[model samples]
Target: MNWMDSLFHELQTIPEVAGLAAADDTGTYIAGMNIDDTDEFAALLTFIGRSGLALEEHLGLDPLVYTSLSGKKIKLIVHRILDYFVGIRLSEKSSISKVEGRINSIVGNLDIEDE
Candidate 1:
């Protein structure tokens, strides 16, 4: 498999992780795993990130860097890296701090890097 695929695999090895997805700054899909309707989901994630930034700008707060959405079944963790985004899906029972730590490492390893 390619490096991107390998990265996705590595991210999933984290306990309680259910899926992973990457999207461009514009919300276009880059890569993903274990997600049905990947494109739609990626686009939705992009919108959420963009909206968060808008909220930050409107409120004159620090630059928004991360986001989290949780449900009874799953939780979505999103990281913004300049013009790109990475999202990790985790089980509701998972420790968010643990998952975020794993995602931070994976995001650091991504070639895109954050600006």
Candidate 2:
């Protein structure tokens, strides 16, 4: 497996994640699961991540680590990790705090990319 694949696999171990995907800084789909249109999703993730960074800059706030949007049936959590962004889709009722810890753990242990 590639680096992104391994990381995504680890993320899949989280029980609450119904779907997940990753995008590079350029908004290209790196890897994903359960997402219908990987290209569109990746693009959306890039837009969201960029917008967050722009807003933080304007407000003089700390860089964004992650963000979430909740809907009636699903919750979308997006994390900016290194030069990539990962989006996790969870059931609306899932415990976000529980999943956040696991996400951080996986991201924290990310291996250095092969040179």
Candidate 3:
């Protein structure tokens, strides 16, 4: 199965998760659908982030499985979801400067350094 399908399946296993599959454009497109509030979104993001990190920790694991472009794409997608949630949380807390600092930190930490 594709990553999106795997994501949906993983979400389904979590009892707290709620929401249609990503393929459900009708459900996803509804006005103010509140995907943020849906437990599935939160759970799925957490799962992907944690699993990716775990995979990275294991030596001799198949690089093709965990370090491939597909794997990085999954991580990037999770990061984007986290960034979205961070924005919403910051809005609620009225902490734009705090969020900006966090984004800066993330970028600075991840940016390639000169050898």
Q: What are the per-residue Cα lDDT tens digits for candidate 2 across 17-110?
A: 8888989889999889999889998998888888899999999998898888777866888889778888988867897877888888787788
Q: What is the C-alpha lDDT of each candidate?
A: 0.80, 0.84, 0.32
Top-lDDT structure, candidate number: 2
TM-score of each: 0.78, 0.83, 0.28
Candidate 1 residue pairs that clash: none
User: For candidate 1, what is the lDDT?
Assistant: 0.80
Which is the winner by lDDT between candidate 1 and candidate 3?
Answer: 1
lDDT of 1 by residue, 23-61 (tens): 988778988888888898899789889889999999999
List the candidate 3 regions with Cα displacement exceeding 4 Å. 1-37, 60-76, 80-115
The parts of candidate 2 lying over 4 Å away from their true place are 113-115
Instruction: Indicate the residue-level lDDT of 82 in model 3.
Output: 16
